[model samples]
Target: MAHKRFAQIPMSKRMRELCKEEDFAFLKSQPDQDQSSEESKLQESQTQKKLERDHRQEERQLNEQERQREIEEQKKVQCHAEKEEKWKSHVAELAVKREAIHAKLHRLREFRDFQKKVLLQDLDPGSTNETINHLLMRL
Candidate 1:
């Protein structure tokens, strides 16, 4: 009977003490846990902001590179156009020179034919100089 009462008193008192210790532990951890949670949230926001800034910077660099490429392409096209224009002008000049040469060749052929006719008239055995002159005038 005495052993049973001793057991009951110790068990109840131990349970009460354990409950008090748990309560104290909970109270002690609350402020520290809250502070850690706040710090974690702040760190997350900072990381998000950094990511956004990096994204914007990357986008700007891409745009700049594209613009530079466009400018270079335009310059190349313009240079090609200028070269084409120069080629066309050179071809036109060559054509003019070719026409002048063709005209000169025609005139030279006419002059050669005239000289051949004069030589043939002088070589004819029966035709006198006066007759040759008359024939030449008729021609």
Candidate 2:
């Protein structure tokens, strides 16, 4: 069996060849020995920092919005509970008022019965004192 050998190109050589073929003049251009344009470096770092800061700000805003919603929901629940309590108290007050009205009606009925009895009884002026005494005793 015969073994076939393949030629392998170095990675840096291949990159250089590709750069030449593509006419990528930017990569081959040299900067002052310090490396990279100061303006471009400053813009890149500032842009990255700005993006991170903006992301954090957005997250904080979202969290605040969520907390506000929760607070609103709790307020709604509390308001509903207060309304329910007010309704129950109103109902109880109405019941008490109704009972008082019933008691007054019963007292009026008793007074009417007493007046009817007095009208039905016929007494002479001489016996008025005796009738008064009898009525007082019944009471």
Superposed on all Cα atoms, the candidates' RMSDs to the truth, in angstroms, are: 16.1, 11.0
Model 1 vs truth, CA RMSD: 16.1
**lDDT per residue, candidate 2, 11-82, as tens digits?**
476665665656546644534465668866886799999999999999999999999999999999999999
Candidate 2, position 75, lDDT: 100
Q: Lowest lDDT 10-mer window, candidate 2? A: 1-10
**For every model shown, what is its TM-score relative to the native structure?**
0.54, 0.54
In angstroms, give how far residue 91 of model 2 lies from its true place.
0.9
Can you tell me which runs of candidate 2 are displaced by over 4 Å? Answer: 1-47, 123-139
Clash number for each model: 0, 0
Q: Model 1: number of clashes?
A: 0
Model 1, 8-119: lDDT tens digits are 5545766767766887898775656547777878878999999999999999999999999999999999999999999999999999999999999999889766865776
Report how far off residue 137 is in candidate 2 (Å). 26
What stretches of model 1 exceed 4 Å from their correct place?
1-42, 120-139
lDDT of 1 at 122: 64
Q: Please report the candidate that would top lDDT against the real structure.
A: 1
For model 2, what is the error of residue 29's alpha carbon versus the real structure, in angstroms, after optimal superposition?
16
